[model samples]
Target chain A: MHDKLREHIEKIVPLSDDEFSFVCTHFSIKKFKKHQFLIQEGEVAKHAYFVVSGLLKLVYTDDTAKEHIVSFAMEDWWESDYYAYFTQTKATMSLECVENTQVLCLSYEDYKKLCDSLQKMERFFLEKANFGFVGAQRRIISWLTSNAKERYDQLLKQYPALIQRVPKSLLAAYLGVSRETLSRLAP
Target chain B: MHDKLREHIEKIVPLSDDEFSFVCTHFSIKKFKKHQFLIQEGEVAKHAYFVVSGLLKLVYTDDTAKEHIVSFAMEDWWESDYYAYFTQTKATMSLECVENTQVLCLSYEDYKKLCDSLQKMERFFLEKANFGFVGAQRRIISWLTSNAKERYDQLLKQYPALIQRVPKSLLAAYLGVSRETLSRLAP
Candidate 1:
């Protein structure tokens, strides 16, 4: 698990063995069963999780209780109610395990400590944040321009593995289309 | 204008006089008339702009000649074809002046230099990127859960000044609605 984290961080900024050990101390590993909630709406989002294994979904539930998939995190991906995490506010969204999951969790306090102590980690996080923003912006563009079938096709082309792994209903939610519409769009 | 940039950065990370001077060295000021392009599709995006005055719109033009407003950047906001700027690729989007605009431009190489030389700037940028991602995520959620009228209302509620400033046609484009639909949604 630690090796997975080290490799993930090293992809952005190489870490010495000593630095890697120091980084490991800031994160604690946890396991969750499939369908378990990592974060729930109205609760404070305390930590950001880096997935070592398995899958997680960040979902926003509307007034009528329709769940909208905000994002999915798989191996080596980071997931959190980030707005809540950064602002120390109650989450408007929930994160749940889609598969039996193992994640390395870093609390906001420890995240700050790591950044203050190590310049490399701050650079790594900046890179992640920039790319995260880019990905979200791309999705916004897709929403503005593409219809359900086009979005589904783009998703299949971009992440065939994710398409295969996610249930159709969830994919429908993620794409902001009805399950029936998604079924029509998909094979 | 430098004061605006300093104030913006200082809001996230305080910088000394010397540090601010060093930061200023990496940026150059440029002015554009309304309808001028800061970035053009298929051209390499050489710099990211920090708006000191006026407004800019980042736009994506679809194959059918329809334009989608990806975002609007007004005073004290950053605007760029970020994917292209970050990757040194040709822009998929175009950035244009909505109002006669003045912006501080940071070339990618100078941006790297600033981040490498000043840790505080890197921290400041990280903070910006995080909030930028949060804002984009909120927009995605709105797209998923809200109808055209609801989205127009939300935009008006959140950015009343922007609503007053932006043309209704562009607002319609930003909301992914037809101009006729936006007229019905708006006052």
Candidate 2:
């Protein structure tokens, strides 16, 4: 499990074995059954999880109580209510396990402590966070400028595996479109 | 001038006078006349500029040669073709001085050296880059979901000074709307 986690971290910032082991010591292995809530809105987000196996969905609900899918994370991906995690505020989003899964969870406090202890780990987190920000910005731009079909095409091009794992309705919500519209556009 | 820059850097990371001075040594001041190009499309973007005085416009031109304003930087702001700078690719966007400006420019090589020298400076740059990404994502989402008037109001709320300094046409381009429409909506 440590080796697998290290592989993901190495993609962002190469870490020595000792540095990786030190950072790994802070993570708690969590297992969730399908349809379980890892996080819920209105509570402070304490931890961010990296998927070791299975899938998770990040969602927000509207005033009408309709849930909108914001993002999905599979193996090697990280998920959390970042606003709440970063600001120590109540969460506006929720996280649910879409499949029975295992994750490596790290509390913000532990993560900060790990960063202070390991320079490579700190750089790794910083680089990953920056890259994630850039990706989010690009996704937002694509959503604003592209039509439904174009957006669907872009999603497929970027995350082909997600199409197989995520439901069409959830994918529609992620794309900011209706289920019927997405169905028509899907190949 | 160095004091002002030091204060700006301190917003993200506390830096001692010695550290600030060391960071400052990596930068060179450059002056630009109004409408001067700091960077142009097809050229490799080599430097990121921190505005000390005046304003700069970041824009992209389409195949038809029509320009779209991406962003404008004023005093205490930083501007660059970040995509090009991070990836070391030819710039697709251009940076032009909207007014006579003085800026502290840091080449990518010098910036990397500074990051290696000071861990705090590295974290500062990473955090700022992440903040920019988050801001850009929110801006795109707002553009997609909000009406023109709401967007204009939000833009003013975020950058009150831009309304007075930037031309309406450029603002319209940034908002992805026409100049006439923006003029009609302006209070």
Candidate 3:
């Protein structure tokens, strides 16, 4: 699991053995079954998770108790109720497992320590954050300019593997369409 | 204007005079009249702007020749065709001055140089990027769960000053509503 993380980081910044070892010390690993929650709304979000394996969904529940899919994290991706995690507040969003999962977790304290101890890790994280912001900005553009059908096609093209793995109902939620509507749009 | 930039950076990380001076060397200032385009579709986005004063709209024109408002940047805000700016490609959207605007421009090359020279700037940018991602996530959640009226109200609540400054037609575009519909909703 740690090797997976090391490889992800090394894609952006090469790390020496000593550096990688030091990086490992800040993270702890855990396993969860399908339907388990990594973050629960109204509780403090303690760690930001990096998925080593399996699938997870970040969701928000409305006043009517309807679920809205915020995003999905799979192999090699990171997921968190980041507002809560960064501000040390109660999570308004919840993260739950969609399949049996393994994740490497980094607590806030350790995240700072790692950045302070090694500048390269800070650079790596800065690169990740930059692209993360860009990704979100693109999503906002998609929402503003595309209709449901266009969005569905865009998602299908961008993450065909993700579409294959996620259930139709969940995919419908992520695309902000009724299952009937998504069914019409999808092959 | 430089002081505004320094104050914004100091909010997250305090810099020494020498450090701030080095940072100033990397940015240049420019002025734009209303209706001027800072970035145009199909042209390379050479700078990521830090707004010193006035308003700008980042717009995407769809194949149907309909203009959609991707976002608005005002005083103390940053705006760019970031995907293009980071990747060194032609812009897919255009940024136009909504009012006479003064901006501090940081070219991609200068941005990289500043990050390499100052660890504190990296930290400051990392913080900005993280919050920018979080803000976008919240917008996505709003799109998923809220109706137009709810979203309009949320926008008014969050940025009351912005509403007073922005024209209703543009706000309608941003909210994905027809101008008539927005007029009915706005006070």
Error in Å for residue A81 of model 3 = 0.3
Alpha carbon lDDT at B33, candidate 2: 99
Instruction: Please provide, for model 1 over A1-187, each residue's C-alpha lDDT reduced to its tens digit, 9 standing for 90 to 100.
Output: 7998988888899999999999999999999999999998999999999999999999999999999999999999999999999999999999999999999999999999999999999999999999999999999999999998998889899889888999999999999999998878886
lDDT of 2 by residue, A72-170 (tens): 999999888876776678888899998898999999899778867776776777667767765775665464355789989998999999888998878
Model 2 chain B: weakest 10-residue lDDT segment is B137-146
In model 3, pairs of residues that clash are none
* Clashes (candidate 2): 0
Q: Chain B TM-score in candidate 1, rounded to 2 decimals? A: 0.99
lDDT of each: 0.95, 0.82, 0.93
* Most DockQ-accurate candidate: 1
Lowest summed-lDDT stretch of 10 residues in model 2 chain A?
A137-146
Q: Which has the greatest lDDT?
A: 1
Which parts of model 3 have CA positions greater than 4 angstroms off?
none
Give Cα distance to truth, residue B52, candidate 2, Å.
Answer: 1.9
lDDT of 3 by residue, B118-183 (tens): 999989988988998899899999999999999999999999989889999999999998999998
lDDT of 1 by residue, B129-148 (tens): 99999999999999999999
For candidate 2, give the DockQ: 0.38
Which ranking of candidates, highest DockQ first? 1, 3, 2
Report the Cα lDDT for residue B7, model 2: 89
True contacts kept of each: 0.97, 0.21, 0.84
Which is the winner by TM-score between candidate 1 and candidate 2?
A: 1
